[model samples]
Structures are given as C-alpha cells and as structure tokens.
Target: MVAADSTMRMEPAWRVLGCRGCGSAIVECALVLAKIPYEREEADYATKEGRDRLVQLNPLAQVPTVILPDGTVMTESAALVLYIGGVAPELGLVPDVRDPLRREFLRWLMFLVAAVYPTFTYGDEPAKWTHDGEEELRRTTDEHRKSLWRLVEGAVRGPWFLGETPSALDLYVSVMTRWRPRREWFAQNCPRLYKIALAVDADPRLAGVWADNFPA
Candidate 1:
C-alpha cells in the first residue's frame, strides 16, 4: 500500500483507503470536487496484505473504505458521495432537497448502485460465485449491464445527467464507463453518457484524481 500524501500528519483529514482504477476513484473525485482535504492509502485488493488491511477496517474488504476525521468508518460509494455533499453543499454535487431534479437524481443514483453495479460484482469473477456456467454467467451479466446502461442513457438530459448541472450521477457515469463493456461501447450505444464521462474527465477539479486512477 502507498500513502498518497501526509495530510494526516498535520491535521485530522478524511482518509481514503482504496485502490487506483477502482470504484474508489468515485469517492476520491467527490472529495476533490468538494475541496475536502484527504489522505489516500492505496489498498490493492488483489494482494493479500492489501485485502487484509481493508478487511480490518471493513469486513467486506471493499475499496473506497473511508475513515472519517472523528474515526468513523464509511463504505459504499453512494453513501460517501451523499455525505460529502452534505458536508459541502456549495459544491453542488448533490441537488438540494427542494431542487426539482432532486427526485430524479435520487432515483438514478440508487438504480446505478443497486441495479447496475452488481453486474460487475458478480460478473467480474464468476467462479467466486459458482463453478457452473461461469462463462455463461459472465456473458449474461455483461449483456444485462449494457441493457441497464441503455436505460440510463434514455433518461440522460444533456451536458450532464440531470440536464444542465453536473451531479454525483455524472461522477458515477464517468467512472463506471471506464469499466466492463468499455468506453468504446458507450460511445457507440450511449452517446449522452459517453459525453458526460468525457466532460468529467476534463473537469479541472478532478484532473489529479483522474490522472492518478486512470493515467493517460
């Protein structure tokens, strides 16, 4: 594991334990966009030691495990995104409770994490789930994931997921597109989401997080 910075040494800052190129990138980008001070510990789940460390903090050994300043532990990308938005509402990553888009935002956000994200969880390593029809399971999940993306694409507004303003939903599109079916597929099939991903990739606020997690 590698320490991204020594911010923890000087003050009580948020600490993120995650691996590069993983879902943790979503949380990292949220922190950066919120202008939150944080220290990152690269926890490569593929390695035994890294998995052990993460398991200690989170029994599930998930990436994007966050250590709050008050020593509270937080997991799940969507939850962390919401927490950051609450702490830094001025960032506008989450729509206000009164915003009309608030309902749509909440709707799709849960859809992504609950309905879509699980495809990768089970499909990425089929053998872990079962020994039978591993290849079939992967193919089915991939197709299912693509169908879910198409559903999201149909709902996308423009310039961002919710029409004009960017939000955590856009952040999710930006990161998840880089996985599985690949960006090439998205460009051809889900043009709106593809554009949002490219826009997020170019956002100055998240340049460092993108570079570290998805180096050119």
Candidate 2:
C-alpha cells in the first residue's frame, strides 16, 4: 500500500498497481517517458498480501494492472503500452497510425507479449502449472526463449527495435533483456537488442523508474 508523494496538492491521474522489478516497469517507464501523472502501488504477486490486493483489481493477479483515471481497470502489458501511446502520441513511443513502421511495430509488440512473455509465465513457476518435471520445463522454456530472442534479434533494425525511431518495443526489449537468460547472454547472442536495451537504460527520462525497478 505504498502511496505516491502525499505532498503533491493534486491526486495523480492514474494509479498503477505493479511490483518493482516486474513487467509493470514497462508501464511505469511509459508513464514517466510520457510525463503522465501517476502513482504506483507495489503489488508483489509473490506474497499472499500482494496477490490478494491484485486479485481484487485483476482476477489473474498480474502485475502492471492499471487503474485508469476513469476507474477502468487495464491489464496486459501490450494493451497498456498501446493505451499509453494513444495518450501520448507526441512522445513517439508508438509509431503514428500512418507511419510505415506501424505494421512492424504492432507485429513484434504482439510477438513479445503473445510469444515471448509466456515462456516466463510458465517457466518462472513451473510448479504452479505442473506437478512433475519442473526442471525439464524450465530448461525447455529457457531454450525456447533463447530461440525467440534470436528471432527478435534478426528483426531489429538497429539503434532501436524499429530502426532509428524508438517505440514501446524498445521498452520491452530493454526491460525483458534484464530477465532470464540474463544480460551476459543477450550481449553475446543478441547484440542488436543488447544495444537497444543499453540505450533505453540510459534514457534520462526513465532514470528514476529504472533506478526504482532495477536498483544498483
């Protein structure tokens, strides 16, 4: 139940319920990059208390569950990214509807959330999904994830996932590369994406968000 700065005279327009070091950082980064007004609630799904709180907002109890200013509940990082982009198209975190790269943007965005993210969902806690061969499941998923990263590496256009322009895809690459398989593996095998991750990490707009979600 950690609150945002109470000293502010006005309430933040958005309430983000997310755990630090989790996928929620994507939304947090977006908000910060867009200069949107928001407050974050630490909803650590690993603990019963955190799960209970998130379950109230989202049945799946997922991190990055967002309560919109209108009180609408939003989940799924991809959807949230799109929504944030819609709200702040000037930031260029999402390609314009008319941009040629918009198609590729949408394609890989779905690829990440639909294809790559599930590997972590299932692999991170094999016991939750299966009663047997947890080790095998983790290993299999890790290999599969590596293969997926290779696919992404091939698609990357350089400087960012979508070429010279940055998008939410860059944010995904930035944060996710820090997860399983680790930065060392990404640096060796996915150099293009590794460079993008490093760029995103260095963005001064997200310095505070990155610091809080991924400490020194």
lDDT of 1: 0.90
Off by over 4 Å in 1: 1-10
| lDDT string, candidate 1, 1-216, tens digits | 223353345557888998989999999989887777788899988899999999999998888999998899999999999999998998788999989998999999999999999998899889989898899999999999999999999999998999989899999999999998999999999999999999998888787888789887
Give me the overall lDDT of model 2.
0.90
lDDT of 2 by residue, 30-75 (tens): 9887777788888899999999999999999998899988789999
What TM-score, over all chains together, does every model reach?
0.94, 0.94
Q: What are the RMSD figures for all models against the true structure?
A: 2.5, 2.5
Candidate lDDT values, in order: 0.90, 0.90
